[model samples]
Target chain A: MGNIPSGINTPEILVDVEKLERNIARVAQRVSSQGLKLRPHAKTHKMLEVADRQLTAGAAGLTVATVGEALNFALHGVPKLFIAYPLWINESQAERILELMKRAKLSIGTDSVAAVQQMAKMLGEKAPKVKLMIEIDSGHHRSGVAPAQAVEIADAARDAGLRVHGVFTFPGHSYAPNAIDEAVNQEHKALAEAACLLRKAGHQVKRISGGSTPTAELSDNSVLTEVRPGVYVFGDAQQFELGRTGWNDIALSVASTVISRHEGSADIPRRIVVDAGSKVLGSDRPAWASGYGRVMECPEASITALSEHHATIDWPEERELPGYGEQLRIIPNHVCVAVNLVDSVLAIHPDGAVERWDVNARGLNY
Target chain B: MGNIPSGINTPEILVDVEKLERNIARVAQRVSSQGLKLRPHAKTHKMLEVADRQLTAGAAGLTVATVGEALNFALHGVPKLFIAYPLWINESQAERILELMKRAKLSIGTDSVAAVQQMAKMLGEKAPKVKLMIEIDSGHHRSGVAPAQAVEIADAARDAGLRVHGVFTFPGHSYAPNAIDEAVNQEHKALAEAACLLRKAGHQVKRISGGSTPTAELSDNSVLTEVRPGVYVFGDAQQFELGRTGWNDIALSVASTVISRHEGSADIPRRIVVDAGSKVLGSDRPAWASGYGRVMECPEASITALSEHHATIDWPEERELPGYGEQLRIIPNHVCVAVNLVDSVLAIHPDGAVERWDVNARGLNY
Candidate 1:
């Protein structure tokens, strides 16, 4: 279990340690040199080892998508953490958040007055008022209050005696190819508007945060003090599709063995079925993706379809297909979701020796 | 966590221990009463506990999608296991298959001569030859050899001194609502044709395995000797959309809390955002699905969109939405993938006691 033996079985998620380190270093260096703090999203890797590398590479703190993720990172001694997600504050979550705050310097996100009020009730003379960041809907329309409403929420936080840290927005629309620039522009506009609104409302908008993997490359660091780019560390098919990164930048792949072959036929040409299917590789083929996932070796070929246990790969007529049992690495469309699906990832060194890292944060869905 | 605590969080996956037991019993009873052997697929739960229940419910064996899954069940002492997937035979898988054969009766699926030949080479001089199941493409067209070509692979398996046990196909196309009947009919035709072809080729086709959750409900057991239905134990959105099961039959859900609220504007109506997103709930919204998933309490509403950490839920006009931090349960579109994303599932008893079972087969991708 220490070193993933070579020819490691099918549907196994393999991470090239060398490439991963390089990917981490590349992002860390870019963010640090820009004088902006890098709070790499732990939601991507969900692995203690990868998070450690991000911290080692000069990350100011870590960003987690859930309280459970925050707890896992805290357990690994990640000192400063941001629960980037706008959590719903409940009695159970309040208890968990209070306990987590005691263990680490934590900041939580919220977009509603009710949430802040609930947080105030939970804090109630214990451990001081928690820091809160107002989430603004910057074109994603997924979460967050409107920029106009940000001031109201910030005021509510202040009224609740909670420390208002900053404003945050996720330009998740950036995931679409050719939408990165628009997303970054939207991020800047939303954060600027929200910051102005908060300031007008007599609150200090100290930290203006925005940036997804796609927009991070073109982010306006002047308006935003921090950028949370999760997937940059291990570029995925989404990043590639969005023109944010090249295939060479993809640092992770699910290594799988070809288990079945359909020779050239009149109707269907050469096709190979791999052991990696929806169960392992995930069934996340975004509307923009060429297929469910891209084959690393045969980039032209897409995973046409996936059964629960078999990846149906249709190769081009001109391309030579690998024989049955041949192992091929696949770059998944969405790296974060794929990472979350597995228990552990094979961390392979430059010399090809592989180390196994437990996905300690594998299932922190609570 | 031995007993799931009361108010055991919203949007949390709860496996009704009783319902799950009933589902197991019902399926097992059908198999037994019909005089057909039951080989429950472990890909759905990926839990040893669930597999144990299947066995205890009179399952003749267990069916798995991967060698890794097969190994997991075998380790848990399930002596008979079928790797129902058309596996690509590699050196590592071959070695593992040989080892698995030592502890459990192993049946593997293949669709190519190359795979059969490779497996044959790997099983050379083994105590017992691995049983082979020729996968026939019964209109699912995802994987499996052509029904007419089943004998080619069956003959190859026999020539390799492997036990050509039977033929198998996944009526995966039945997952779509309109295609269920057609897929089931095609499955019967394919199985019948393959069985006849194998028998005519001087091979005994003892098993005719075909059935997915959608087709299992109306499957003609008279034609097939065995039925492999994985998702029936915990019905998912696919089953519901396919009209295979009602919402009451869904056994698992992700408990999420409403984190944010937005008042209606001229352009947009009132909305509530939940903490559960694609990462936890999985981004699987088939065209027929109401939304990304079904809300347990508010079945009328639909989750409009999902960012990595946010689920944007739209409500009808003037409806009182759940307050921020109010817990809500979500039934994901695909339960199998959602379960695979998490490490452990919280099994909730009727009395509100929660037991955490190790997803022993959680990341057995290979």
Candidate 2:
């Protein structure tokens, strides 16, 4: 709505610092008031600045998806970190994790006995240095052992001389439309059952972790000691479509220019093509998602198609179409994947000065 | 499948050198024999080594999607470069283009008269230093003027003292099932009509560039002076699904490890989760695509879903599922986007030696 900042190139991510802080504070406050630990997933922003904001808002620690991400945070002196993924740790990765443990309290997730045994074999005597969280399959069914199998994995970790700290699950199925309540319920039941099983098996299950952005607000604190919600820091189109966050709450957007515009005729609809496409905005359109992404200015407009560097937006008939070279802010379908595509994001500070935040863990998928 | 090489981590791209060379050679021979110059799009691999191979294989130049990509190749001493996207150049970009033109012959695509006028004003006396290509909409309609509007934009560029190179159109509609022939026809007709209109308007149209991976093999060389195909070097699942490439033709794949596996029960279907997800393989699934990606070793296996770092694969019933820590090669839905996701790719040489090829133009989307 305002002037697109000069010197900021098209198809670049711009983080609204004010909105980001609000998003952070709001979630932190909610989690804290509910008496649950907030360990915001660093995979979303991957920026030290965003992690700092979350930490400053009283996050217990940072949850990472890979050892590379964990090392990125730990090297920056983040005191506590967790790799919340069932990692099949290789010899080289084991060495990195050992080095990482020296800087921070590192923990990783494991769902299988073989993975734990391999982690132990790779880490050897240093296995106890890294704690393990047995992943539980709530209902999302992507990864994690069944609730009954939590004891088996915990026993395997214990037999491998690793510390079984707790259990964790990712209620990713909550992302679908009208599935939030079911996902929350399953997450609660799974974590509760897994914790009970581990306790009965003579293991101290102190930490129970679960929560995606859609199910974060409705997390059962009675079962979950902490929640890891990454996308809450920068709401995406998925969260918006799932009615988790409103348009005003979306903090991250791609600043792109209209490169081409076609006024509608009787046969074809009016549309404007923007420079930002899957390369910058990402192509993570779920079946429930409205489009590839959303136009911040025109909420009803749908980005019907996207090429590598071109997004074709079906312009609403009632509104005047933007001309060539006109800049528009676009909310990506998935902020995490979009953020991972670029080296850095332009963070617009509260004072209107733009600062570059390096995506320190940009492509650290391994 | 052979052993997954040591030292290479999971969820990483592996480019088979022998297959890559063969793929490159085949395409080069086909295009050269047709009497059309080959300008391979660097957006596919984005590796200088791959570009060098393409150049050595008789490619006339490299076509890029952005000014940054053009600069990347130019700095690496690539003799000729073309930014084939309709760029809305700002002052900063104009400065970069001027600097870029000093190192190599540069041409850019423009669909609007306003864009050409702005280019002229931005470059001023140096406008002629760069060439302009009028992009015609050949039914894809993402960006580009209609065939009839080519003369208007060409006239604007010519009046502004810019050299009108020719007309180019991307037949992106060729990416669908049973649509390759129609796309080729539309591309030929559109380019021919646009070239005719431009010639009648007293402009020397030397180059008529058009061709995507799907339509490249069937391109009408009589009307096309040069053809640009990005994904021919490294076939992806999309190309495989479109019947444009066979499984053996795919030169690039993501080396992923199975982190979790589940056998089918009465209700739930069997699936395995790999480390390669949207963050690595990229989430570029068209509705017509079978799945998120494909397992190279198991062609029938479908990557049913993808999280940021987990790909849930639906393994075939006949095949024995890969165990945890077992590595698998995964072909992404789109090779270009997958290549852009990482900083480097592991190029498996003909001698079986692995080399790291830096994606020098990885995130040069701006």
Candidate 3:
């Protein structure tokens, strides 16, 4: 990565365009080789530039987690968009989705009969091309229904005059250590079973979408037609630590200045404090993760704790601590959360020009 | 504790103005009773309306984390502001701060001679009544120098033509369970020692500031001239779980919709999924925190995991799960981080009128 501009402020998100494009291209190629369509999840970057790059790199469509995000991308003229979340649509949101449907080919996810009925009730007879994918559990157990239960949601949607566009599952369990193989296996099985049940129920099981960044490489195309991996575009510390990506593949980082450095005392260990804390880096440290985040410049350094405006890096006494005012790039454990925290990100190009990309879909949680 | 407006969307921040005023007044009265000046940290709410409420409640000044935040408040006509962070000021930041000094009485925290020298050099001879407070490490061990080292920093600042106003420390250790008394005690001792050292070296330590929300009520006025409690204005899950504040005292909460609900199968446990996740309610789950956040309606339930837009609640099967589209209030583990995630908050008044309060200093993380 190129050096951050001295004119730019510290504790800012810096996206390396070269690595970003390479990461997107590599994933596109891998998905193509596996005979699967890539519907890259736009929830990761939430930037129009990143979404445009992914679409230009041969992504079939963009997957989002909210109607607001879908509308944001749709308004930006993304032809096809998928809200890959089981949304509990209110009347206003339903109206917004209906309006969005006129601009883009939109498909939302539903795991329950109640949500399907609510959408149907909100839209009534004026509903236009309402399409939904039945969400399957796939061992995540957070959202989505059981493999057999997908048929019930599909039946409800079909009865409610909404088109059932096959099934989808999020292998959220893949985020953990050594669970990728099992998560991928469960994902495949759940999608296959759900698709079979839907087909048996006389529904056209056209798309079986399933994939997380961790299990994207091992995804099987036999039962799945499209994969929706979000974090592949910007490799995070989680991906790197999980052996999914290399140091060179990390595209997005927080450019932070070391504000404080301390030598070991009897009560405290030697540490360097950076301005990028939970507000910038986010506080998404999984149980298995090494620390709050990983320092790209000093891999051995562990960010032991995070205050709102400070990240305490536990430096090895052997290595010299970074000097005060020295800028260091940090890879957040989860890049999506980090990206959501900022208004815009600084994108550094290979030609040494840095541009700011607005996170247009930021904070569109609804 | 009023019903959320139907027009407002889900996963949005809702501030109870009544509780907010009460929280501010209660803390103000307590600090006043102890004869300590209240300089509530603006980092928690970052809203002008909330800051105004605290100021009206007799806050001496506002405390901020960065120069950008300080400038935001200063521009909003807050007369006195303290950047309660050990900032590594660059030339540009120094220039901004220099411009800021013209409008407000500003004091910044410093922990090292290098930072003091950098600030002094950057401010040049045109520096306007520069006030520097030596930060002492009062057992948090994140930033701040040792008690004896405070004199060194104060000496450097004094030698550099900067006024050493006093010393301050963040009793961050108080956030944990049963750590309040010890943290307050240590805070008192650290400030006392640092003030004594600075006094012995011929520096007039006028304002010895200390106090976090957990230790604010237990603060010793004998050593501290001012208590800077940020989170007391908006009680969070941390404060509520730690017994620092009652449930009725929580002012800010995320209004979320129950998007999906699932009964336990053989492999999965029963859970209710809400739209408000880590993006709305930040992912700061301290080791001692019960979960990601707390549900006001269902205190018995635990938010087991959070996705970017989904919070999985481990709802007890004994009670019927909330229906789809039902709105519930969630108290985030860290109110400051949660407040920073949104552009504006909906402040519900006592008479049922809801007003939008723009988070003016939302992303002003320098």
Question: In each prediction, how many residue pairs overlap at the backbone (N, C-alpha, C within less than 3 A)?
Answer: 14, 0, 0
* Tens-digit lDDT string for candidate 2 (B242-274): 999888878999999999988866766699999
| CA lDDT of each prediction against the hidden true structure | 0.79, 0.90, 0.90
Model 1 lDDT per residue over B72-164, tens place: 888778999988877766676678878787789888887887777777777777713677888888876667888788887777777777788
| Best first by TM-score, ranked | 3, 2, 1
Per-residue lDDT tens digits for candidate 1, residues A103-217, read 8998888888877787788667652456688888888777787789888888877777788999998888777767777788888998999999889889997888886777765
Against the correct fold, how does model 2 do in TM-score? Answer: 0.98
Q: How would the docking of model 3 be graded?
A: high
User: Model 2 chain A — which ten-residue stretch has the worst lDDT?
Assistant: A1-10
For model 1, state the Cα shift of residue A141 in Å. Answer: 1.1
Return the DockQ of model 1.
0.59
DockQ of each candidate, alpha-carbon based: 0.59, 0.79, 0.81
Where model 3 places Cα greater than 4 Å from the true spot, the runs are A126-128
| Deviation of model 3 at A32, angstroms | 0.7
Per-residue lDDT over A190-239 for candidate 3, one digit per residue giving the tens place of the 0 to 100 score: 88888888888888988899977998878758879999999989999999
- Our model 2 lands, by Cα RMSD against the true structure, at 1.3
